[model samples]
Target: MKKRTHTRLASIVGLFIIASIGLYFILSNLEDNIVFFYPPSDIEKITNAKTKIRVGGLVKENSVVILSANKIRFTITDYKNTLIIEYTGILPALFREKQGIVAEGTFVNGVFEAKNLLAKHDENYMPPEVVKTLVK
Candidate 1:
């Protein structure tokens, strides 16, 4: 090959290697950080009931039970099903019945054990899948 042709081939090969490395890191980061969403029904089918997962649903009406100053219990529903969620700590003002919520934790003894609770901030918004479920 001519000198110029050789240089061009090397440049392309170097670019391909760089791109592959970048893509690998990006995918690895996503796998570690991304949390999968599982509805109430899916949680039951999961064999690793002890594994932590994210559950999104609406707070069931009249289910907010305050057990103590820092502890609270409530039922989250997907309209078709419900799961009791327990949290101990300050809850967001937006955390209330009939509103959307995403709880992150494991399920233990029939209760959705939550380590963190995130309440929807606005009345008109909901996670897209949850909203779609509610609509149908």
Candidate 2:
């Protein structure tokens, strides 16, 4: 009975150790993969050139240049600030000037290189933060 109890305790402790190690690995990976979202103004302050991130703001009115009806260049503004975005993919149907947008990419050579762009949909909906900025 004593030997059996000892074996059970050892098995429980081994399982606990394995679980702890697994938890640590998952948490570490989560930290490494986490990406931050910022507005144009926030992106301007970033200095880590290699870190991937996202920018969200309102597309500037009349700033869009449809290079080929597919490739597009535009500026996203946080009212007092703006960032130029270049993308060469099929833009979402909702993409337009003066609308809310979020772009995931890197900033290099004084431009935001967008890998993906998401445009706001519908007149009744605007990103809450952007609307608040516009109201102020």
Candidate 3:
């Protein structure tokens, strides 16, 4: 009986060790894919300018400038603060001035270099992060 109990305890311990290692690997992989969301008001507080993030806000009116055929510059505002985004891609069909949008990229030289731009699907749609900033 004593031998049997020792074997059972050893097996349980081994299983727990394996489970912990598996969980560690899963979390480590997920960490790389997690993109944080921020509002224009919080841009000044971001310490790591190289880290990729998503900025959600409304496009400032008359702030869109077509710098080139594929490059564009625009300002995003959360009513309290504003951020300039530079993108080199096709804008979504729904993207327009005074509309809700989320741009994903890294901050460089005081500007957000967006690789992807997402616009609200409809007039009533607003990114939740942008809405949270507006509500405050």
Candidate 4:
């Protein structure tokens, strides 16, 4: 009976250790993959400019500038604050001034270098994150 009790306890402890290690690895990978969403007002607060993140807000009116055939510069605003965004790719059809958009990219030299841009599909549709920023 004593030997059986020891074996059971050891088995439980071993399983717990394995589970802990697995959980740790899963969480670590998730942290690396997670992309945080920010508004134009909060972009300045982020210290890690190299880290990829998403910014959601309205495209500032009259801020779009065509730098080249594929390059464009625009500003995103959360009403009270704005951030310049640079993108070198085709924009979505719905992307236009004053439209709600979510831009995925990294900030460099105070500008958001967008790798991807997402625009609402319908007139009434807006990204939830942008809606939250606008509402605030």
Candidate 5:
């Protein structure tokens, strides 16, 4: 009976360790996939180059510069600080001056190299994150 109990306890401990390892892996992957959101004013606080982040603000007036090769450079501002974003490929229909938008990418060399843009807002509608930052 003593030997049987020992074996059962060992099996349980082994299963517990396996479960802990699996859980750790799952949580780590989820953390890696999470893209954090930040306002333009707070952009200077981002220090991690490997992590992707989203920046939300209004398009700075007359800051859109169409570049060659389907690339475009623009500025975003929360009326306090501004961030420059460079994106390649077609832009969204709602992309315009004074409009609110969010761009997701890595901040490199003092510029945000956007890989994705979220500007699907309609008239009289803006993203909650943008509103929150601008309202302050």
Candidate 6:
């Protein structure tokens, strides 16, 4: 009976260790991949450049500047604050001043370097996340 109980406890501990390791790996990967969204007003609170994040707001009026055939710079505003974004790609057809937009990338040296840009699909469609945080 003593030998049997020792074996059962060992088995339970072994299983617990394996499960703990698996849970750790899953949470770690999710931490690296999870991107949090922020509005322009709250962007300054983030200082980590290595972590990817999303910024959503309306394009500021007369802020879009075409730097080259593919590179463009613009400012996004949340009615409280503004942040500049630099993207090197063709913007969507619906991309225009005062339109809702979201950019995913990292903020570096006071500018948001965009890896992806999402424009509103239509005149009436806006991201639910944007609407929740936007003043209007």
What does candidate 2's lDDT look like per residue over 1-136, in tens digits? 6999999999999999999999999999886345446887777567686667788899998899877866888999898788998888888888888788988888778888889988867668788798999999
Screening candidate 1 with a backbone cut-off below 3 angstroms (N, C-alpha, C), the clashing residue pairs are none
- Candidates 1 and 6 compared: the better one by lDDT is 6
Find the 10 residues in a row with the least total lDDT in model 6.
29-38
- Per-candidate TM-scores read 0.69, 0.66, 0.70, 0.72, 0.64, 0.65
| Model 4: per-residue Cα lDDT at residue 79 | 95
lDDT of 1 by residue, 1-136 (tens): 9999999999999999999999999999887236556667666667777777888888899999999999999988887787888898889878878888889988778887799888876656678899899899
Model 5 C-alpha lDDT versus the unseen true structure? 0.86
Cα lDDT, model 3, residue 57: 93
For model 5, state the Cα shift of residue 2 in Å: 23
Q: What lDDT does candidate 6 reach at residue 107?
A: 73
What overall lDDT, based on C-alpha atoms, would model 2 receive against the true structure? Answer: 0.83
Candidate number with greatest lDDT: 3
Backbone clash count, each prediction separately: 0, 0, 0, 0, 0, 0
What stretches of model 1 exceed 4 Å from their correct place? 32-36, 44-51, 123-136
RMSD of each: 7.8, 7.5, 7.9, 7.5, 7.8, 7.5
For lDDT, candidate 4 versus 5, the one ahead is 4
Best by TM-score: 4
Off-target runs (Cα >4 Å) in candidate 2 are 44-48, 67-69, 78-81, 122-136
Q: Give the backbone clash total of model 1.
A: 0
Q: Give the C-alpha miss distance for residue 105 in model 5, angstroms.
A: 0.8
lDDT (Cα atoms) of all candidates against the true structure: 0.83, 0.83, 0.90, 0.88, 0.86, 0.87
How much does candidate 4 score in TM-score? 0.72
Clashing pairs in 3: none
Clashing pairs in 2: none
Clashes (candidate 5): 0
